[model samples]
Target chain A: MTILSFNNIEKHDGHTIVFPSFQLSIESGEIVGLMTSINVRTVLLEMLRRKIPVPDQAIAIDGKSIQQLGKSYHQRVGILSIDDGLYERLTVKESLLFYHRLFDSKLPIDGILQLTQLEAKRNVRISKLTFSEKRRVHYAQLLLSDPDIYILEEADQNVDLETKRVLMKVVQELQKNNKAVFVLTSNMDSALAVTNTIYRLDEHGLHKLDVMQQEMEPEDEAVEEEPIVQPVRFEKIPTKVNEKIILFDPPEIDYIESSEGSSQLYIKGDMYQSMFTLNELEQRLLPYGFYRCHRSYIVNLQKVREVITWTRNSYSLVLHDQSSIPLSKTKMAELKEMLGLK
Target chain B: MTFSLKRTLAIFQKDYKDVSKNMYVSFTVIVPLLMAFLYGMQGDMGVDMVYTVINMSLSLVGAYIQCSLIAEEKEKNTLRGLMLSPASTLEILAGKSLLTFVTTILVIVFSAMIIDYQPENIVIVGVAIALSTLFYIGLGTILGLVTKSVMEASVVIMPFFFLFTFGSYATLLAERFPVLKAAEYMPNTQLIELAKEVQTGAGFGDIWSYLAVICVWIAAVFILSYVTFKKRMMD
Candidate 1:
């Protein structure tokens, strides 16, 4: 049965109309990809918010007049938004717990946590966690909701190969459970890799590629052989295997830097932002008063004000101007010692 | 009811938690405390009649602060996460209002204790406070929901704080100023009269007419707030 279907769906903002008309559908156990280079994620979120209604000829969620359903519509729809405002100070477990409350009575908590491999980092705060870990937390929250339909936006951003494998496993599990998956991406590779059913969107419109029925055969082999030895590549002494350095060929530090109180960081490379872990970065920059105040953030010591204990040594570090950074329970004493508070 | 109570209380607790951590929220609450302390020392410095105007004025300020708090949350896009949850808009509003009401109650209790203003009829005093609170809180919610940003909500409500405080204070001014004497017909005057009568241990009979006015006003404001909330939720 079709979980969601949209036909001749048109949308308009107060100023302009974007999608003149669009058609889409998802059945149980199907993996669908909505591929548009434009800002489709925002539109989909708006449609989910019902700020923009679905097309007139569409059936959404059990063919119910979902307009009346209100928040219940969210029950069967799990959205992993690339634009989700991440509360970095919150622990991975705490973050999941917050969303779990909303999605309660829908999925078992333990199962969701296990599926996302976040059980180990349950106590680790997100600011202290890795980018991949944060993405895992977001994915876990979505999966734990156990929605019949899943929507992902730029989902591959933080995912490492292992995490991607886990997510694909999750997609497989959801499909096995008859849940429908819908992923949206600007990356053509991700679009092809994750889904069989592709809705290729452009200015003209969307092209629904029927890869599932094997209508489009594999066009060409993607891999082109790299020469055995390019002089510069070999001269670079491929000795140090740093992902960022390896992936991005930069001879030196080229970056746009921004400061958050004591913390100073730069966005390097044009494609993506990069930074060492606060833990790793803090060690080299301790003389600069840049200390690991939170797991995710290394604040400049100049910003540290006073420390207030949250619940039972779940400490909160107030900045010079009284802005607060959360201190994990485990790191409270270490932080105190580091700051000479002890 | 369970969701309302649980979610409201949870939100209220978190507001306090956020308050404890945020210097700004702390500053807001502490400013009143500090002002109340400063005001206490200047005993009878031409302000003995403050008890007459303080109640309603404080109530409005309380409500405005409450509205702005939620307004900030909305501006942060933080409310969307809660709005998308199982907590319906009603529950969310209830929760927001509950947080505001609690803050209001604390400020009132502090004012009463510090100012040495005690009413004769505690029940009537309580009811008047409750009604007066509900009226302005509903106003705050509507304003908060409609505002484009936190700064906008505050500016939109800035006149209200003055109107609610000074406008209602006209009830007490009626005794001294002839112009304000005409305010006896105003609903605030009736509520103030009710507050005064309660202090004198008067019966509810003396206040029933004003209570009726209070009821009509409350019903109207509550309806407006409900409609605004429903519209925002739909959006």
Candidate 2:
């Protein structure tokens, strides 16, 4: 059994901090969901791939520092991103065989082919395979390596319902095999469905959510002794503006503007000072069609009118109110998916 | 394990299979042999032509093959999978280099056979060609790391190929222009000079300095390529 721990880990890109002193631990037979913004996810994956130096006692696997493990550390960790990094010319069998040989793995090829249900497409070139088939091939390749830790980024994106089921089944199998799985995804429903534990990664650090308690709060609180029915609770976020506190319904807020470590809520032509940090507000409002489109702005998806591509790398979200909000280039695809554009 | 020769051989075989399917890479391997055949037909199979053929084989074909193989990986984004694998950087480098090295030697040997060029000392000529091949492969790797696509790699490698191979001809103009003599110190020039010494029956002791110069060039290029590759991989 392997255990991976992050003890007060801090990561930064130059002066801008990405992960700020977060502590997390995952052991075998558990699936952990890490929900992070698109930009932070990109930077985090890059750091993990490069094996950037970590502070002493910050990160450890199996009770040993990752830095001290050297190349052997990768042997225990497997990563699967949206780009599976497959060679189009290579057939499914040949691709798996190549990785198997490169890793000097003892796992049998037939077992992997069977596990991924790719036995019928063994001889088919990756280019000829469907996107789901290619994804399965990537899972098969990862199975050949048989790592103790699996990190999957955006595993559910652009996949059909059936493919998502197959992926979830694979995740279950990995858990049964005593593998620790960490999934980073923007799809909250899928994450909530498969993962036993959920954590939100914001500017402050990693915050674990009590999934069961949050889900049961409504029903449990409504069980009063009286026969009278309780009114449905509409969640309201309180904000302070000019020494006065205003209760604003979350759905009514068009966007939140963050500057100088403070935030302001824009609700129907009115601005109010926000008591919470942008990170905290993002977590509280993400389920309500709000997306952290940029570092300083979180726009409600219902209010977004059009997406404007100013350049190849620059993008802006035109809201219904004719106000433009900056969108991260890396988050464009996800935003499109969220908007059902493609 | 940091590296394994068996794993490296496995990667080499995979590369061979991949290259066979790529028409452009296959054509690159054939170009040098075609040049050698043309030189043989024209009766220009002298020591100078032999050096030029060897230079073309190493710098032109070698650079294209190595650069394309790597750039294609980056284009396909499979290098990241390899990097994330248990295989060490040394194993990947050695594995990829093995195919380039073997194919290069085969092209050079076939070219030499077609030209009917005979060296007084076969060992010295082989060493010189091997060292030159290593140096060119290192340079090719650097080009591959910096290029974003196979087309970019081809465009970037062309000017360097000409400057290293055809640029040696500048030594012939050294008497008229003193600054042109500096071309003699180029890696390809040193390789040609070493090959000429072998043709004139020079022993190991007589050509030690030339060998040293080529070795230094090999060391410098290899170090630079490795550094660049590591940095690019991180980025």
Candidate 3:
């Protein structure tokens, strides 16, 4: 079931447009990530939190308008902001129990603690817990609320790796329970870590980011094994933005992602679309120290900073700026050999 | 908005543990008891002094503690968490106020014991005190809603504390300054007046006027707090 839906959300800050007619719908058993700048995220969050009604029945919970829902909208949509907001004096168990009762949740206290992985520190005061532990307590509170739709704001930000993994697991668990999850984060990498249905919202409006890397193909590895060395037709990769073709040096490009068949070149943090296909770009840029890290992604080798092994088959290449690109298992072995690492 | 005693008690229980551990707020609860002890040593304290200690307890524990609790929640942003919970506004407010209420009543009882206050009608005095506590809690709620942090709450609450707690004494200057006469209508002053009337064998009928004033204060403060809370909900 579709738990939350909003459309035609237009907001103007004086003469400037904050959001020029935006819309989104989150269904049960789905996790959607909306990645944007901090300013855009703040505006989007304000709209969601205040339920500022717009024309054409824009915001709704289970198809009912926010106005009709009134304050009950909060009961159906739970948001976890960046701040943990746990009482420093209250123990983890005490805090979760308090929210449990407030939410009228029948879920056992120990069950929530175990889900948040805070059972060992159940009796410890929030003040004594580490920063990540406090974040877990906050997640525990939201879990106990058990809203139909969960909107998390930068849940993985500024936490330890363990906490990030714990949050990812919790999101997966929520999805399994048929709860719709919408994550709003400024970091693309964090959004990718959580879910693949990612969208970027900005002044230009909302655009879905092609974050899901195509599954590895057996024949693609053979193609990579034999590099087709060709003369570099042009060192400048051409991309179009505002109808202006901006030529970028091969080294200047951080990565090229093909989403829904069109190639997008990411330089610094900005995105520009290229006219070339991913396969063509891969063949053209291979001599310029670019590698096909994933079926949908071609990354500049100089920009690859670290190789993160998430699981036996899952890997990601962390760029210098901390942005990540998916690395297939076979490609990982090839990249390791290219770096002369046995 | 449905009210749930179970949810309210859950909040009260959480606050009970929270307040006990928060030394900055718990220390304010002791101020009235210490004052009562000092007054008890004086032997045969006057009615004004006895009411002064009781009013101090109401203002300090009732208003100050409630304000700090709400302000701290706002400071840490937990108030938003609670507001978004399934609990109703009344439940959250009542649960939070219940803690301050229990602490204020306990202090009032202990202070009465220490000062050996024997009123003509305990029932009437208790009613006045109870109404006045509601008034203070409302004041605290408004104060907590207006301020963003616990430190800001502490600073913003000082003027209200002095006005409500010492507004009764300010009435003595009414002859010299007629503007000060308005202070006589403060709930704290009405509580003191009702206590004095009870000491003189005044029945509930005779003291209903004083109770009316405190009730008005409660109604006004509660209405204002509700408005402020609604405004702050989005802020």
- Estimate, for each residue in A176-258, the C-alpha lDDT of model 3 and write its tens digit: 88999999988766777878788777766877754435345466667889978877656767775442344667887899999
Write out the backbone clash pairs for model 1.
A9-A55, A91-A125, A127-A295, A127-A296, A128-A295, A128-A296, A262-A300, A263-A300, A289-A301, B120-B199
Worst 10 residues of 3 chain B by lDDT: B79-88
- Candidate 1: give its CA RMSD in angstroms: 19.0
Residue A219 displacement (Å), model 2: 16
Q: What's each prediction's TM-score?
A: 0.66, 0.76, 0.79
At residue B198, give the lDDT of candidate 2: 82
Off by over 4 Å in 1: A8-23, A39-45, A55-57, A68-71, A86-95, A106-137, A157-173, A209-342, B1-16, B42-61, B168-190, B230-235
lDDT of 2: 0.82
Among all windows of 10 consecutive residues in model 3 chain A, the one with the lowest summed lDDT is A209-218
The segments of candidate 3 whose C-alpha lies over 4 angstroms from its true place after superposition are: A212-265, A268-342, B175-179, B230-234
Top candidate, metric DockQ? 3
The order of the candidates by DockQ, greatest first, is 3, 2, 1
What is the clash tally of candidate 2?
0
Give a tens-digit lDDT track for model 3, residues B1-235: 6678998999999999999998888888788889899989989977889988888888888988888888888888787777777777788888999998999899899989988888888888887888888888898888888888889988987887777667788999999999999988888887888888888888978989999998988999999998988897754
lDDT of 2 by residue, B54-146 (tens): 899998777778888889888988888887777777787788888899889999999999988889999988888898889988988899899
